[model samples]
Target: MGLSKRRAHLRKAWFKKGCVSPKKGQTVAFPTVADNEFVRFEKKSFDRRVHTSNNVLTFKDTDGTDTTVSALRPRPNASNVVDEYSGCGDESLYPDLCTNKLMVQAKVQALFYSSFKEHRQDKPNCEGDLNFDAAYSIKWGLGWRELLKCTKCSCMCDYHNLYEEVENKKRSG
Candidate 1:
C-alpha cells in the first residue's frame, strides 16, 4: 500500500523471524541469535534507523531515478541569525555589486571615443575657398585639421586656421 505501511510490515516480519532486534533511539539491528549457519551471520548483520531531525536524504531506485526527501519543519531563528551575521549597519561590504566593472569601464571608454570620432566626422563642412594643400606639413601634423583635410578635401591646410575655419563653418552650417 503506502511506504510507511510497507516498511512497518517488513519490520514486523524481520523481528518475528529473529533476524532483527530493536534498539533505543529508533534503531534496528540484525543480531545473531544462534550459530552454525553457513551464511557467516555476524558479517551479514546491519542496522536501519529513522531520522527525526532536519536533514535531506537522497536515494536512488532500481530504475535509476533519484528521490530526495527533506524535513518538513522550518528552522527557528534563521532570519535573526542571518541578520546578526551580516551586521545591522554596514554599507562598505556592498561596493555597488557590479559583476564586471573593468570590462564595463573599458566598453564605456571605447563607446565615448567612438562617439567623439563620429561627432567630429558628422560636423558640417566649414572651409569655404581656402586652397589648403600640404602633403606632410610639420605644422598640420596629426591634428583634427589634418584629419579633416585628409578625409574631406584630400589636402592639408595650416593646422590653426583649419581648426578655426572648421569650427566657424560648423557653427554657420
Candidate 2:
C-alpha cells in the first residue's frame, strides 16, 4: 500500500486502541524519510493538533543528496532528551519536541533496517578470514573495481567505477 494510506490506516488503528485525545494544532501523521514503508509512532502529546514536518532545517546538495552540517551535531548532555542509541542532543525548543525528534530518528533507523533486511545480500563471513585483496572483486559490470576495506572490521568490498569503462568504450567506438 501507499505510504500515505498506510499511515492513515495505522493512525486510525492507533486511535481506536486508546490514545490521549489530541489537542488543536498537533502533528497527526508524518512520512518517514525513507524509500520504504511506514512506521507507527507512539502518540504522546494532546496539547496541540497540526500536520507539519518535524524537520525544521533540511538542505540538499547540487547532487540532490541531503547534506548535514557538522556544527549541527549536539554536544554531550546538551539536552534533556537522551536517545538510547544516539545519545543526547543540543538544547531543544521544548522537551516534547526533543523527544519527538529522537522518536523520528529511531523510526527512520527502523525503516532503513527493515528495507535493508528485505533486499540486502548476505556478505561473506570474514571472521577468521581478515585477509582481503583485490583478487576477489566480483565482475558484474564493465568497470574498474576499487578495493575497499572497513577500518573498524576485517570486511572488504569492491566498488565499481564506470569512468575507465566509458573512456575505453569511447576509444573503441
Candidate 3:
C-alpha cells in the first residue's frame, strides 16, 4: 500500500477506536460572572496575594499611563527544541541528554552538511575556478569543533564520537 493510503486507513481506524474525532459543530456556552467577581478570581489566580514582602509593583510608562505586569504562568511539560549552551547556540554544549546517542549523531551530521554548504558559499572562486585550498579546508577540517565550542557552552564532551555512535545506531536500526 502507498503511504497516503496507509495513513488514511490508520486515521479511520483511530476514529473508529475513539482515539480521534472531529470537533462538534455546536458552540460551547460559558457561564458569565460579575466584573467584581472576575477581578477577585483573577487577582487570586494570577497575582497570588498582595503582601509587603511579596507585593508586586505596578507602574506607568513615561506618558502617565497605569500598567500592570502579570505574574509568570506555570508551563506545561512538553518537548521543546533547546540549543547548545543549555539554552541557545551549539548543540554540542548542551547535548540533548534526553535523546539516545543515535539521535544526537543524526543531528550532528545534519549540522556538518549545513556548515559545509555555508563554507563553500563564503569562499571566493579563483577567476571562475574553484578555490582548492578553501575546498580542502572545508572537506578536511573546517574547525567545526572550535567553531561549535566558541559559539556553544563549554562542555567537555566529544561530539564527533557521539555523532559516530548515533550514526551507527541509525544504520543498525
Which model is ahead, 1 or 2, in terms of TM-score? 1
* Model 3 CA lDDT for position 158: 24
Which parts of model 3 are misplaced by more than 4 Å? 1-44, 47-102, 123-173
- Report the lDDT tens digits of candidate 3 across residue range 1-173: 55798788887667565443565576878997534321222333333332234574443333546434333443434444553323534544333332222324465665555544544455433123211121112222222221222122221222332122223345554
Using lDDT as the measure, name the better of candidate 1 and candidate 3: 3
Evaluated at residue 99, the lDDT of candidate 2 is 26
lDDT of 1: 0.36
Arrange candidates by TM-score, descending.
Answer: 1, 3, 2
Please list the Cα RMSD from the true structure of every candidate, rounded to 1 decimal place. 25.2, 28.2, 28.1
Task: Name the weakest run of 10 consecutive residues (lDDT summed) in model 3.
Answer: 130-139
Residue-wise lDDT of candidate 1 within 21-41, one digit each (tens)? 565368557796544322211
How many steric overlaps are in each model, in order? 0, 7, 2
* Candidate 1 Cα errors over 4 Å, as ranges: 1-64, 73-97, 104-108, 116-173
161 in model 1: Cα distance from truth in Å?
36
Question: In terms of TM-score, which candidate is stronger, 1 or 3?
Answer: 1
**Model 2 C-alpha lDDT per residue in residues 22-48, reported as the tens digit of each score:** 664786687667553322222321112
* lDDT of every predicted structure (CA atoms): 0.36, 0.38, 0.37
